[model samples]
Target: MRKLQFPVIFALFCGMVACNGKSGNDSTPSSEENIKKEEVKIRKPVDQAGYDVLLQYIANDDTTGLWPVPDQPLPLEGAVLPYNRIVAYYGNLYSKNMGVLGEYPPDEVWRRLDKEVEAWKAADPNTPVLPAIHYIAVVAQGNAMKDGKWRFRMPAHQIDSALAIAKMRKALVFLDVQVGLSTVEEEIPQLEKYLLMPHVHLGIDPEFSMKDGTPPGKKIGTYDAKEINFCSEYLAELVRKNNLPPKILVIHRFTKGMLTNYKDIRLRPEVQIVINMDGFGRPELKYSTYERFIRPKPVQFTGFKLFYKNDVKQFPHHMLAPEELMKLRPRPVYIQYQ
Candidate 1:
């Protein structure tokens, strides 16, 4: 795994106050009354219920850095758990090197995907399986585009095809984004309409988030906590506005540099986070990476990615079994095959 080239200049501005054309000491009784009236006129109604819930979960001084990983079927009062152990086939419709997703026709892909799903179901009989199609909505390209961003976004029809497959499987759909020169903030809103759907979730590939303007695949890229937090907050807002179950925000990482500021990430009840190990190697090497990179830095949940071609390229002739993966300390609740 390559290290991120830390930007030389990083600045954060905090809490600058604005003046309203009135001096601090110039308050007469009439002026004070007028200011109070103006404040009342502009103030928005408070969400008392939301505030009450926040207050209930508020941490004290001693518990400042002690945020617990959310449990399976995240308990959010009345909200129901949408899915439990997600098994997804990951890739795009255009690239064969990508994964099994684009290697075969739709019917054949679904047939193979169903077999994997059933294997997971048999392995984790206690948890219901949610089949998923993790489509690469945006792919990193070798050549830069007109904007000098070496990325090509799949058209809406490509995504619709994945959604249709998910519908056929009664599964969830994840639109994976690989931001080459673009920011997550810029790319995510483009999929807002699709994300608004109940069964659709999101996956952000930090491996292609080239923050330093380096073309993707030349070197591994990175995503700081701020970027990850932004995606989580965006999904949380959508959950709140739509009255939907908690949304899962998957961040792919197999190296330390791929994700930064792990402690500063804030998780909410409205969103579940999965820090997925996205590298492929021999079974032992893959397990070692999972242990070293992912398991040690536990997020709300965990995910492991398997590469059908890449995983067996080394000495090993088989991928890690679901039972072997389940034996991980914090078992991976989400599994993706590429």
Candidate 2:
């Protein structure tokens, strides 16, 4: 529940609208033709059908063509995004400060969570909103544990407990890992059993990924494209072998350093990556943070994280509502309340 800092960023640019073009058979492409350059990154045989679905899912205003990144590979079998919106409660069962999932009693948590999902559904009537339990499977610690890694794994029984709770609401389960001093390479394999399940997914917290041997809270952490791609490829293999639905990978970020090499993050048929705006603050502060980190770089999907406690500590003494978030240029499909 440490309140990470968001850098002071200026919202510099506005979403560009598609412009009309003149075709007079000029050898050089017109400014209108070059407009797609900023919107679409890499060009590939686009899945026009699914891409159209992505546009709708984001509630994309025609102003920006960035929501449907041009070359995303088609998902196999059951893909969640563009078809459904996710409302997740994030935390570890042991720590109440981490998020809402652990702040209240089990029955109360489910009751509140169901109401949140309903709110999102009411906000966007066309999309089916499902609940998700994003449990912190690996927690970053101030002290180096027995393995000399500044982290500890939650008990398997606790994860089983999370699965049990998910079953109560038929919610999706996400195992989030904050790999303190240890590498994700060492951590991810340990959770393969749970991840192989059809409904379970993965989340990696870069804010706790201290690669320089510094303690987790000493400074913000980071994840490069190399590490991110590894996670996607790993999940893709799981989907291929087990014939399961596309796995959703959530990456937490508030500052630019929390995630790097945005252009290199690949889009796979079996894995969908969501760059979650994890910063918490007043409405203006949170919106600036989102535009700074998420908008400039378009990932496969997008997510917005709200804090029940941290958010209310500011001026308005309130949390960002579903209606307010929907106004984002590329609306977030995944909503996590901590």
Instruction: State which candidate has the highest lDDT.
Output: 2
User: TM-score of every model?
Assistant: 0.77, 0.84
TM-score of 1: 0.77
lDDT of 1 by residue, 230-278 (tens): 9989998987777666678889998999999887788777777888899
Give each model's whole-structure lDDT: 0.77, 0.86
Q: Give the per-residue lDDT of model 2 (tens digit) for 115-149.
A: 99989988889788989999999999989989889
lDDT, candidate 1, at 25 = 39
Position 26, candidate 2: lDDT: 55
In model 1, pairs of residues that clash are none
Stretches of candidate 1 exceeding 4 Å from the true structure: 1-83
